[model samples]
Target: MIVSLAISGYRSLRNLILPLGRLTVVTGANGSGKSSLYRSIRLLADVAQGRAISSLAREGGLTSTLWAGPEIISRAMKQGEVPVQGGARRSSVSLKLGFADEDYGYAIDLGLPQSDSTSYFNYDPEIKVESLWAGEALSRHNQIAGRSGPSVKVLDSHGHRVPVLQTLASFDSMMTHAADPKDALELLVMRERMRSWRFYDHLRTDREAPARVPRIGTRTPVLSSDGADLAAALRTIQEIGDPVQLEEAIDDAFPGARIEITVTDGLFEVLMHQSGLLRPLRASELSDGTLRYLLLIAVLLTPRPPPLLVLNEPETSLHPRLLDPLARLVTQTAERTQIILVTHAQTLASQLSGCEGCLHFELRKELGETVVDGVEPPRWAWPKR
Candidate 1:
């Protein structure tokens, strides 16, 4: 589980450290940097996948994502004695993202390209530093993999830093370059663990949504982000997973309504068998709420849960009446996997207020910088560069 995440110089987040838990809910007002925080986490995951630059390019380049406010605010500015004015930056600008866990920790730093030549791809971001450490957090006992500029080093059995590769490409990461199973076994493990981290942003359930159409049946242990194979996923759960939870979830949302999957000539369809209804309604005829509830059930009650699961605004388009059941499903999922939920809904945050082992992080803008409300420095010790 991720215990903490630290981000700096990204959008409105000047320098903020967030404490994570098994169930962490991040909530904030509009323009309070909630979405920025979510995107930052995604960027970190992209680094592990060796596509961080490509991911940022889709976001209108690095300049647009960088913090737009001044580098530093003077004491007089804080006291309202002087107007805000631009000045020379005191330090080089770099976007940093990192997280610490009980087993290991990883961090990546991104900055501008060295040569600003006139080229079509000059806006591409470059990785400046990447580090993978061991133990509960990054400390003296840690430092497994460290990369500085174009040089790479790894810790030996005798706890000595031995240079593995001296000259690496600027665009390529050591993690990707050293993924051979025979050599750099630790890198392979780290890559696999990092890849297991799943993220779901939005799922469409409109008139023409794919979940409405019957898909060819196949075993599905995981719900795809698009939810195209929802029926197969649910059927997979019923056959190989906890079917009782699936039934209870459907009955919890809609009393006397049971979910059934019908297969005909390799095509599979999902239906809701409600009481007092002569004929069950197909997925295409079910209400948006009903379909969305089923999708959540398939996701939360998965047979194979990942190490970390991130859901960004799962309450989107959901009615207030359904928030209770949705919250219950989220809490149930947290019991198996670490869940990071970012939501703008105050009701959802309030509903999860007294959840045991849950940490609530409320981000607020402090002088144009993202800060955890009422949190002071030294709350957690960060690894030294």
Candidate 2:
């Protein structure tokens, strides 16, 4: 479980540190940087997959995502005594993201690429520094591995510093490059843990949504990010996972309604058996809200849960009456996996307020920077470039 998360110089998040629990609910008003925080976490996950540079490019590159406000918002500016203004540069441009569980922590720093005449991808972001440490907090003595520029180093068995590799590409991450069992075993473990992190954002329920159509059946233990394999996943759960919990989740949302799967020629489709209906309704005939609810059930009740699961606005297209059941499902799933939910619905947030072992955070913009309400910022130190 991640105990803490930190981000700096990303959009409205000039400097922010958040404490995380088993089930963390991040809520705020519109334009309060909720989406930016979600994307930042996704960017961290992309690093483990060696797609961090490309992910930033898809968001318009480093400069476009960098914080637009002044580097520092002084008390004078806050008091309206002086207008906020930028002074002479005091530090290099940096965008950082990191998280830590009870036993491990990892952080990465990205900066502008050096001036190069031979490369066409000069605008690309480069990994300036990366650190992987043991225990809850990062310290000089606890760092197991470190990456600076193109060089990588790790602690030997005798606790002596040994160079692991050189010539690591700036666009690549150490998680992808330093996978040697002899020199950097910790890197491999950290990489796999990060790769297991799952995210779901805006599952489609439109007329042509993939979940609505029949797809070739496979024993799916994990639901796809787009929920395209929802039927197979739910079916797999019923056969191999906790079928009772699945049934309870469905009944909790819609009483006397059960889900059925029909497989023909290896194609799997979902069917619904509801009260007061002569014939069962197919996935295509189910309402948008009902389809989305089923998708959430399949996700939360997965037989194989990831180490971390993130849901961006699971309440989308859901009616107010369904929020309580959805919240209950999320709360129950958090017991087996660390979950972060970013929502814009007060009803959903309120529904989760009474859940045990859940953390609540309301983000708000202060002088164009995102800050957590009623919480002190955690102490954080980044590796120098």
Candidate 3:
């Protein structure tokens, strides 16, 4: 249940704070920074997995992803009286990201590493500061733990600063290295919760897609990112999950169509049975749109829902008629888990915007920075480096 998300110095998201709800739909035109926002959330998830540095490296390092705009977009620049340009440094180069739930908040600061002649990874970004605080807003008094440079400290039960680590690696996150279950139980809890957040980007439904191939079956409570276990996941839903909802979702999209799984030896494959068909169609025989719709159904109806689920442009390849059914599925899934849907389709966005506990954000570029139209950002404060 993240209440707010704050990102700064990341691509077009230069100093952006967004409020979240049980179901948050983010939509905007092309080049409006929707993809940047999606990648930023994935980067935050990488931190909890101790792969933040490598993730950034794969994206061409901190310099490539850092905001390209000036430190300040002055009134003169906005008025077209002056061009946007960088000025002398007012603060250190830092890329910050954070999120706050109902009871706690966490933030991390990354900056350029100090120059070193002997180090090959000198250009790697360093974790400058990390903070975990109580409540929705971060303040001095609510901070439970703070990590500065290579040192980590946490507040004990009696509210005294207790040293946790003396030399944490610059690439490793405190969420992974300093979250001791004994001394820093809050860190451990937060770390695990962050790890539980699931992300599903564009699912492949091509001829050779993994979801179309038969795979060994298991009682899958969650669908894999590649949807390799689509059959097992659907079978799991039929056996232990909400079978009624599963059938309804399938029928909603393809009127009289239902799903069946056949097992040969240990391999399971998905089959579709539709009205007025001589026989069921194999996964490989299904159309791209149909297969994608089934994949979405499997994902949204997961038996073991994650704390947070993010879907990036899920409406891709889906027919306009299927958007309503997909929206209905998302609305139902939001009841059990927090969902953030990044989409460009106004039809899909319109269908879910009116639902209860849903927040809609239409992002637009203003002077090369992404801004939410007609919405004030929630209260957020980044930890000073």
Question: Candidate 1 lDDT (Cα, whole model)?
Answer: 0.82
Cα-based TM-score, every candidate? 0.94, 0.98, 0.99
lDDT of 1 by residue, 245-338 (tens): 8899888888899988999889989988998999999999987877887887888899999988888888877778888888888888899999
lDDT of 3 at 232: 96
Model 1 CA lDDT for position 153 = 82
Model 1: weakest 10-residue lDDT segment is: 376-385
Candidate 2's C-alpha runs over 4 A off are none
lDDT of 2 by residue, 229-337 (tens): 9889999999999999999999999999999999999999999999999989999998999999999998899999999999999989998899989988998898899
How big is the positional error of residue 261 in model 1, measured in Å on the Cα after superposition?
0.9
Highest lDDT against the true fold, candidate: 3
Candidate 2, TM-score vs. the true structure? Answer: 0.98
